[model samples]
Target chain A: MDGDHACCEGALAAGCRFVAGYPITPSTAVVERFARRIPRVGGVFIQMEDELASSIAIQGAVWAGKKAMTVTSGPGYSLMMEHIGLAVMTECPCVFVNVQRGGPSTGLPTLPGQADMMQARWGSHGDYEIIALCPDSPQECFDFMIDAFNLSEQYRVPVMFMMDECIGHMIEKVTIPEADKIDVTPRNYTKLPPDQYLPFKPAENMVPEMVKAGDGYRIHVTGLTHDYRGYPVMSADCQEELVHRLVNKINRNEEKIRHIIATDIEDADVVVIAYGITARVAVDAIALARKQGVKVGLLRLVVVWPFPEAVIRDLANKGKALVMAEMNYGQIYYEVERCAQGKVPVLLAGHGGGDVHKTEAIAEKIVEANKCLS
Target chain B: MSRTEIKIGGFGGQGVILTGFIIGKAASIFDMKNATMTQAFGPEARGSACSSQVIVSEDKIRYPYVKRPNVMVMMSQEAFNKFSPQIDPHGIMLIEEELVDPAGLPDTVTVYSIPATRIAEELGKKIVLNMVMTGFFTAVSRIISREAARKAVADSVPPGSENLNLNAFEKGYEWGLKQLEG
Candidate 1:
């Protein structure tokens, strides 16, 4: 299966009952699959007029008690920003897939890029946290999409399924497990009656229980600041409380949410930190460096946002230099550097867009970073 | 094998991508080697030439695109002219006899030609030319086993068309063997 097709299968397995999307290259396969299969699966796949409608339509489905998603590329992603912020503010549980292409605006329509990593984290207007996952192959694309949906359901926030064009279009063998073997997290539906329910009331986990609008509940959900009663509470105190709750829900549960694969790190003098397609490239580079007896490790960031700060800090504390490999002009480099906190020199094997970096270039960087062992 | 890169090229509607797919499937699924494929083409769907690259390796394939193809399969004159320049000097070349002309290729490059379209035409469907080419590729290069390619051909084609495609495969394979023997 190709990555996009695998993603569609993953969504189906994860119990996504509704999807609204505007098709764009590289990302179009997801919607195309959904449109074809949703009829048989007894779900709805809506082709909205444009990206803005596509973004908001899924939120409506989510509020109506449906697991939902919207897929897009660069320009579509940019248009969906306001809705992403709306999702964050209203605490909507949904998934968003960005099959990234080169772009500030409509850059490389059919090419690969990882420039949207930072944008996936901060494109929406606000001081809030989001969960973004990067999958390196078709198998990971299938597996990690389930995790994306499960995380979105568990925490009432939009999960970003960040894929690059290379992974989206690349074909590889993917083994999909039987449906019964898959574990999916169901939504946190409130058991309270209409009169007793407080829609915005936080549970012990800081995520409020959900109630469908037409379920005879007093639902007054709005984009503006609201209180536990789901009414407009226009004040600085309410603003502070709401923002803190939204951000801290993800920040406080970072340990539970962070999924990273750390390999060969015990005796390593340098590490390569990367995610998605770049991680595959790093694998070859690390192998090449190993041929010369350099013990380099890899920290594959499965979860790109709520950035894996503690792991990077520990590596820095142990005096291990880091190389951040990405297909962008230093977007994640500064983030890694911030986490390293000047403890060790951090290098970047960066490709601005269109194609992946050569393994030799990454291997050469690993050799140079290993010089800090002394 | 350490790594073997293959590029198959033709006009857009010639199942160019599908040809790359079967090879990858054969190597990775049946032969147990890892294979990765990526494609490129112009905007025109039929007349414009397109190409798909596949890398088969004992280890995982990192770079998805071909750097320089160790083997080239050309099914159209435009495809032959456009992509033959990047072939490894000693690479194996597979050509569709009627559609491509390989006059400028190096003498060191081992050439294998099969009338895949004519064979498919004889088999009553020109759409299976890619499958015929795939059979020729497997027979000539032996990079992927014949049994594996046969299994992949059965798995990749549409339902009810398996027999037609398998026949196409056999025709190309037989022709490839005779081309090598003669």
Candidate 2:
């Protein structure tokens, strides 16, 4: 299957019962498959008029006690940013699948890009946190789609399934295990009677148990800075408590949420940090660099947002030169540089992302970084 | 044992992407090897140029795109003209003789030509030309076994056209064997 189809199948496997989307390039296949397959899976597939309607429609489905998701590409993703902030404020447990294409606005609909890395982190106005997973292959698309939903439900946050067009359109074999082996986080419902349920009250992990609208819980969900009762409370105190819980929930649990696939980084002279399509190309470059006897390794990001600062800092502390390779020129390089903190040299091997980074170019960077050491 | 990169290019309606898909599926699913297929096409569905890159290897395929393509299959003159020059000198070329002329290509690259469209026409369907070429590719390249390619062909096409596609495949395979011998 293609990566988009694999993602759809993954959502189906994750018990996603509602999908609201507007058709967009690279990501159209995800919702198109959902429209075709959701009927058999006993779900609602809505085709909204635009990205705004589609983005909020999934939030409504989530409040109605359904595992919901929306899919879009670059332009559509830009349109949905406001709702992304809304999802964060409402503590909506939903998934946003962004099969990113080259874009400031509809730049390359059918091509690949990783330009939205920062936008996924801080696209919407205000300070908040999000969970974004980047899948490198069709198989990872399938595997990580389930993880995206599970993380969303566990954190009561809108999870971002960050995919590029290369991974979205690339075709490869994906093995889906049996139902029992797949782990799904069930909806955290308030077991307390509807009259006593405080909708915004945080549990031990700072994620409150949820209740459906028809289930008779008095829910006052809003985008405004609300208190634990889910009501609009305009005060510095209320804002501090609400914003801290929303941001701190993921930040405090970094070890649980941060997933980086690092191979041989601990004992390397130069480490290549990459994710999505760039990671695959960097792997090829790393192989060639290794053949030439360079002490090179790779740090492939499974989770891009809540960037893996500690892991990167540790690598930099070892005095290993780090080269960050992404499709977008310099979006992620600064992040790595900040983590490096002048401890070691940090370089960026990237472009604006119409096409993938060439293998030899990345290999050349690795060799040069290693050459500077010796 | 090492990686073999194959590039298939033609006009959009020629099943160029599906040709790469079947080859990748055969290698990865049926043959238990690792393969990845990435494709690109223009907005126009039929006339515009389209291409697919399939990488097959005994080990995992880390890089997705084709670098120095070990083999290239061109089903149109435009595809042949566009991609043939980029192929490595030691690579192999497969062309649809009815549509593409393999002139002005690198001298060292071994070139094979077949009238896959004419053969598919003889079998009463012009659409299965890719299947004939895929079969010929299976025979000539031996990247995946003929059985593996046959299974993939049976699995990929529409239900009613499986028999016809398989027949077209067999014709091409037989022709490929004859070419290898003659």
Candidate 3:
């Protein structure tokens, strides 16, 4: 399987009964595959008129108590941001697979890019938290889709599986473990009587138990500020509380989120930070650098959102020089600098979109950083 | 930590993608180091100018892509023309003799010409040329074990074609061992 197709397979394996998406380069095959496979598995697959409709339709499926997902690439991802914010505000548990392509507006429709790291983090309006996973391989694409769906359900938020064109079209052999061998997580549904249920009432953990529509509960969902009763409210306090609660559901649990994959930080002089398709390039560079007698390590951000600042800060305090490499100019690099707090020097290897970072270039940077340290 | 960057290029139906995965899996699963693989191309149903890469190292792999390949396998004339100029001076280049024109190769790099398609045809499996190239690569580079290559082949071949592929692979394995000895 390839990354995009694996995403569909993984979503299905994670109990996604509905998928709605537009046909876009690098991500169209996912929808095409789902069109054939979803109905075979007794699931619903819809080809929406555009990216916005596709996104909203998936959220609607989630609202009706079905696990749902949508897949798109660069241009489609741009069109879907408004509804992405809606999903965030409504606390809808859904999965989004954005198989990234080179872009600032179709820069390279068929090529890979990590340019959307910042977009995935802050494309939508308002100050809300999000969870996004970057998969570098087809198998990771398969496994992370399951994780993405699980995270979305557990936190009652949409999760983005941030893939790139490189991984999306790349094929590989993936072992689909026996269905009974894997552990699956589903959303926490409201158990209260229909009359007493408050859609916005959350537990101590800040995540509310979701109640689906048509379940005899008068569930009202919208992009506007809503009260606990799910009615639109214009009061400043109501707006503030609604946004804060929505953000806190993810923010408050930053320490508890198991989305980071950090390797060999202890006793290391340099920490190379990267994510998505570019992270794979960075990984190779670090290994090559170490061979040249530099004690370097890697900090791979599987979850690119919420930025994983705590880990970055800890590594900075440990005196590890950080190098930020991505297919974009400097999106995640800025976030790393903010988290580094001047504790360590931060370097960058930027490739706007046309070219990916070469391991040799990364290795050269590591050597330069090591020379400065020595 | 040792990092070696490899690029494998061929037509879409040549299993170029699987060979890349086998190399990466060898580095990650068998050798027990971090490995990252990336490929260029779409339209999975057909083979075009497909390319795949693998980065292998002792420590965790930081970056997954190769800027210029230290080793490259080109199974078609167009692929060879597209990638051969980028091979490092001391790098190794493997070409499919039936497709590549040796006259166009760089003087600094060592080129190994293999009759991969011919070998596969002789073994009654012409489509297994990619596997033959992969087996030859493992023998020459010793980057990954032949056993690992076999397992990768077994794991990746689609249903109902496994037996024929296994037979094809055994013939390729013997050819690879001979290349190493030579």
Candidate 4:
């Protein structure tokens, strides 16, 4: 299976019963599969008029008590930004899948890009946090999409599934386990009676339990600043309280949400930090660099957001030079540089989104990064 | 082979991508190897020259694209012109005799040509030409087992057309074997 199709299967396996999306290149296959597969499985797949409608419709379905998601590529993702902020503000636990293509504005719809790495975190205009997962292969695409929905349900935040076009279109063997073996996280529905339930009230984990509309619960879901009773409370204190919990729920649980795969970093002179398709390409470059006697290691970010700060910090403290390789011209590179805190040199082997980086280019960067050690 | 890179190219609607998929599936699913397939996308893929790259390996595939293909399959003259230069010098080349002219290819490459379209037409469906080429590829390259390729053809073709497709594959495979013997 290809990554896009695998993502759709993963969503269905994770109990995602509603998908509202407008078809876009690279990402279109995800919803196309959903549209074809949902009817037999007793689910809804709506092709909305536009991305904004698609983004919000999933939230509507979520409040109707269905596990929902929306899929899009770069241009559509840009149009869906306002609703992403709305999803964050309303604490809607729905997946937002961006099968990222090259872009600032409709750039290279058929090619891959990691430029949206920062956009997935800060595309919406506000101070908020999001959990984004980047899967490198069709197998990881299947595995991480399940985790995407589960994490969204667990954190009550819109989980961004960041997949580039390379991974989305690439075909590889994906072994799907039996349905009985897959673990799906159930929605955190409140057990309290309608009278006793405060819609915005937090539980032990700082994530508020959810209740569906028409369930005899008075739920006032809005994009505006709201209070514990789900009513608008337009004040600085209310803003502080609401925003703090929205950001902190993800920030405080950073360790629990972070997923990184590190290799041979203890004694390496250069460490290559990458995610998505770039990470797979970097594997070859690392081998090439190792042959040239540069002690190079790899730190692949499986979960890109809540950026694995401590891991990079530890490597920087160990005096390891860093190389960040990505399809875009340095989106995650700055994050790596910031985390390194000037403790060591950080280099970026970046490309401008039509094709992946050459192994020789990345290998050269690895050797160059190692040169910084001497 | 520890790793074998293959490239299949043709004009759009030639079932080029599906050819790559079947080979990858045969290797990864039936032969218990690792295979990754990536194809050309966008406007060019609709009706113009397009290609699909596949990597089959005993170990996990790291890089997805084919830098230089160990095996090249060209079903159109345009594809031959575009991709032949990138073939490994000492590799295998398969061509559709009715469509492609295998000129200027290195003598080191073992070139095999078949009238795959005419053979498929004899089998009553010209659309099964890619299957014939796939069978020839399996027989000539010996990268994937004959049983695996046959099973892959059966599994991949549309329902109720499996027998016709398998017959086309067998014809092509037999032709390839005769060429090798001569």
DockQ of each: 0.66, 0.77, 0.31, 0.92
Question: Which has the greatest DockQ?
Answer: 4
TM-score of each: 0.96, 0.97, 0.82, 0.98
Reference-based TM-score, model 3:
0.82
Off by over 4 Å in 3: A172-175, A288-295, A315-320, A342-344, A364-374, B1-38, B42-75, B86-99, B104-182
Better of 1 and 3 by lDDT: 1
lDDT of candidates 1 onward, in order: 0.90, 0.91, 0.81, 0.93
Error of 2 at B66 (Å): 1.4
lDDT of 2 by residue, A1-374 (tens): 99999999999999999999999998888888998999997998999999999999999888888999999998999999999999999999999999999988989988899999889989999999999999999999999999999999999999999999989988999999999999999999989997788999999999998999797777799999998789899999999999989999989887899998988886789999999989988998998999999989999999988788898889887899999999988998999999999988888898888888889899989988888777
Lowest-lDDT window of 10 residues in candidate 2 chain B? B40-49
Which stretches of candidate 4 lie above 4 Å from their native place?
none
lDDT of 3: 0.81
- lDDT over C-alpha atoms for residue A116 of model 1: 91
Using lDDT, give the best candidate's number: 4
* TM match of model 4 to true structure: 0.98
Question: Between 1 and 3, whose TM-score is larger?
Answer: 1
lDDT accuracy of residue B28 in candidate 3: 69
Fnat of candidate 4 is 0.88
Q: Tell me how large the interface RMSD of candidate 3 is.
A: 4.4
Q: Measured by TM-score, how close is model 1 to the native structure?
A: 0.96
lDDT of 1 by residue, B1-182 (tens): 48999999998778899989999999999999999988862253346678999999998787778988999999999989989999999899999988988989989998899888888888889999999998889888888999999999999999999999999988888888888899
Cα miss at A245, model 4 (Å)? 1.2
Across A183-246, the per-residue lDDT of candidate 4 in tens digits comes to 9999999999988999899999999999987788877888889999889988999999999999
